[model samples]
Target: MAGSEGPLRLRDWLVAQIESGRYAGLSWEDADKTSFRVPWKHAAKLGYQAQQDAALFRAWAVYKGKHLEGTDKENPSVWKTRLRCALNKSADFCEVRERSQLDISNPYKVYRIISEGTQGPGTILPLEGQPGLVSKDEDKQSPSRLAQEGSLLPATLGPSPLADHGYQAPGPTHSWSSTLSEDFSNPDFWLHVRLFYGTALVHEATVRTAEGCCLSPRAIPANAAAEYLLGPQPRMARVHFPEPPPGAGALRHLLPHLERGVLLWVAPEGLFAKRRCRCRVYWRGPLAPHRARPNKLERERTCQLLDTRRFLAELCAHLRAGRPEPEYQIRLCFGEEYPGPPDQPEERLVMAYVEPIFARNLLLHSKRLGSETGP
Candidate 1:
């Protein structure tokens, strides 16, 4: 009996999760330990990706900083003077030899000095008769004079140019919908907003085709506000999600919400009002619910109702089992009261529905144990 409380304790918890937008960790291994019969492929895949993505992001950051392009190096002229002074003070009279035979094995070691100083090598020593070398006449000039020339040395030392280009790290390729309707013909100024989950996320960014343009990037920690003023554009504007809340990454669960990216119309004329002046969007992406084939048991019941509460409760029980399912799908709805236009007295009700489905589609073979031990 799959009711509010029954044999499947996990099912009850799932009901609560659906209503409040919370999820319980359900992995295949945990399911095995808990002794439930559900398959583990979906949950394992989800956990694997989450872990991989985290590692990839960290690697990308370190690589990017270490290989920053166009960043000027330490001025060579400064380095030369600094190296010369340090070598003169050192007790080892191997400065000139060390500089001439620069050990490539150790880049961090003290640099050698090439000069007529007592600590320098005999070959480069200031001479009464070395014709083409630092001649007797040239020795008259002070070290300070030589230091000035060192400054002109080029400052481009690091990774090869090809290694430092901005290449995006590897990950699952996302297939965006063709619903994007960027107006290529419009010559007048138009602001574009990249929206997702029935809400304008990035905000209204100003667009212009003129010299000197910039774009700002922002992220929403949580799903809260909309209609942001993302200052004027032609600027490369972007919106990023910091960390997805509860059920975001799990596609099987949240597929309905991400069915289509949303859009909005933001014009400079009414920037002050922040009103829904024009152009309401209605693009939708794929949804798990719409794709869910009804269970054969419920085939005849066309009006079968899904109890939100029961689902949440069952979900929790499953998570508590320890070996929980890797993924789950939960439904959510949002409502806000917006004061309509000045002429319209009533506040408009803005409603949005979000559904998230968790699926561990990419788990490693070792983690996929349910099949080996037939449930």
Candidate 2:
């Protein structure tokens, strides 16, 4: 009678009955019993309602599907087999069993449909004839479980405030360049970097060259540009490097023409080739003084290299201090400057940024080199 409205569908009426507290505290068995009492235009209408109720019950069972053990096992093995088969056939429409919150032993399984898409757990639905039906254990457990798991059960144990009207949870936040620049120190940003690069010594980094290429420690012909070969025996665009100025440090002396120079300790074989070697190079430099400050794109590239250096310097310091290395990836950027003609294209550099991959192997390699070299 409560759900009797003009042209209201049976499923909609059933949802309304539960929401209006007309059938509160009624188990599936009891709700089915009450549905029989609804007066209809004809017996066929009554039969149709029954059919709808049966279909709804089946859907509920499938959505809440989980393996039952002990006293909660309600169906025979054969019935469960048939149910599993039916659920498998309708997998896309039904909730995945692994993802469902319905515990096999939960007494509140009958109320799951009523609470579907509700607000956070611990919502109390007062049953019509049962005042103390909300169990004390459930009252304490729900909030604790929600806190521990960081998720809410859609519908279970009570009425959902979310289900009463059109309500939606806030969408997940997406990371963009601005967001990354603002919070480069956030663990999530580093996690994303690690995920993108996988577990390798070489990582993808910002390049100043028109043609992007990865840099590795290796010899280059004097006439050729220093860009690392993407593959064996094929020459690529050369990176520019002018002479370094006098009074520069020993590392800077290696490349006299570059500005804002820094030394990068590279494996003897470079960041590529698997063979063992020990070497260092003056790999990165800042923009020239006469040049304007880098635009947004260049700033991002510089920030990436700086962040990588910070991480690696920390790691190296930790290793030198004889402290246990923290479980994290170490990243680095290698750069080579290319001098351009004044009237033609401006000078640019190639920066090869590497992600933390095969980290333990690198650590072991470093240790072995240190031991052999007595450092």
Candidate 3:
């Protein structure tokens, strides 16, 4: 270990060196700086020793351990698996690959740590399915070149049609006046409509009823609708509910049931419009079942809200934004109120939900947002 430093500091510096590829083929400008700044908080939650924990600081920024910490005490194997996933995501493991084909660029390069020319596992990313440690012969194959041998791939819906002349699913086609009832004054009714119509009607109705603003607008693209609904808060999921005829089958079951956090899911097709609407709901977070369905043959469960006020606050923020009567989308927020430092009351976990068209695209694009495009 380096002189005058504890084991933790030494390990952290080692991780930075590995990340910069000083021991590999390449070296980065500020890799060492980030090592201390990155994974300190995460290592604390993981219960890593001071020395081993510093290694984490050299790699990741924050840790996600609220739920997993308890589970780790009861189950060792599961904990290691979870830890492995978090640690494996460091830049040292990432490789340049063909964006379109997702194939690794180099086959001969393999990354490992060396001390007096001996191998170690401070920051290692072995090929998929193989042990985190691989033999020198196996180094010929780049970790990035390995195929996803045993991962669950998403359901392929064929190449994207949106790139063509606007892939559109027909929305409900009826005179605007025909759908609104004489006494449909309730805010909840509008909330349901927003989920199905993708905010085209929600904003229009709000302006006409509450603020009386006359705004001519076009359909709000699905993606913008969701982000707009989320307002400034970072939302991770969206939820959908069923329309009346179904008597709240799956929709009824899913509410904010988690001890903390939110839940979102796809809205049922029946609830949205007389004719099928292309819009989909993006439910945020995972919650337990509100109430089990009566006819649940397989006995599936659902979720419910833990704090209605927080949910309403986030929802209102979206509604009150400049576009009172937005044409493209409608959104709702959910929240939970937790006690903070003494004498201070603050709302936590403000989540939002919107139509799926917006939600799905946001998720797919988020991971690749700033990444440079590949030919």
Candidate 4:
């Protein structure tokens, strides 16, 4: 009677039998040592013979026509490799990898063959350490075992004094300058400023802050108040700045403070309560200490600065056309160091998001905008 049921029922029954100690000291791990006949009806329903043939063809394809010894394409070693590769390519497999925090590069660590069934192929299951594969009792103790750790911090900020040409402060209500003036020295105040802008740099920094504060990036208390401040869909725009002459790069002693600037307007519900928006100047860039050797960090900072400048310029043009929602201009000053140069004066902007997904999407959109605008 039990054999007539499908694999799901069979799995349950086998688990129960093992828990009951049906085979004396034998454990569930030893179930493969014993075999049970597959009911004829179940075998037919599963198309066992066809599945075996298909599995053999798949294994053969993996060899790319290289002749294997005999007709043993069903060899356990050969089939397992093909199966593992096939499983790894599946969407479910990727989801499992993310949830279990499994190393994507490690193929052998993910799954194991649990049973070589009598009627059909073996059953492959995620390994013991995989999240959903763990015992239910253990899962009950911690529902979200695969939660991500740590937050991200902003990579950079700008318009440096040298790059600040054409920049204009937004109107009073939406002015970041006004807010900063009230608490210019406070790191916490900067945190609020970043939250308002909600750029990728701010998001990354917020993640770092959450980790340092022992708070989950997903549920930072500071982010709760400004949740609605961010527009429903964060947008990306491109700004065009005069390109430095090819050979002039080496001799350029100083970058501009305002490459160009614009004014923006926001609806009453936008970041500012007033209808007018002003661009507030803030610097964001690599967090590495000034003493660190120049390497990829320097290159990245340069690229980010240029991109941000272009984005802001494009945004200014976009605002001039008139937008339906409240708008604000953000001035990004790129600097070489966190403390920056003595003359430049660095300002930190720390921002937080409810989840990394929102932050990631915003960054992606910005990248897309940059790409569309070209170098």
lDDT of all the models against the reference? Answer: 0.23, 0.26, 0.25, 0.24
Selected candidate, larger TM-score, 1 vs 4: 1
lDDT (Cα, 0-100) at 165 in candidate 2: 19
Candidate 2 lDDT at 346 equals: 34
lDDT of each residue in 280-336, candidate 4, tens digit only: 223222221122222122110111111112223333333344323211222232323
- For model 4, state the Cα shift of residue 200 in Å: 25
Mark the 10 consecutive residues where model 4 has the least summed lDDT: 268-277
lDDT of 1 by residue, 298-370 (tens): 1101111122122222333343444443332211111222223356533222222211111111111113333
- When summed lDDT is taken over every stretch of 10 residues in candidate 2, the lowest stretch is 268-277
Better of 3 and 4 by TM-score: 3
Candidate 2's TM-score: 0.16
TM-score of each predicted structure versus truth: 0.16, 0.16, 0.18, 0.16
Model 1 lowest lDDT segment of ten: 268-277
How do the candidates rank by lDDT, highest first? 2, 3, 4, 1
Cα RMSD to native, each candidate? 33.8, 28.0, 23.4, 24.1
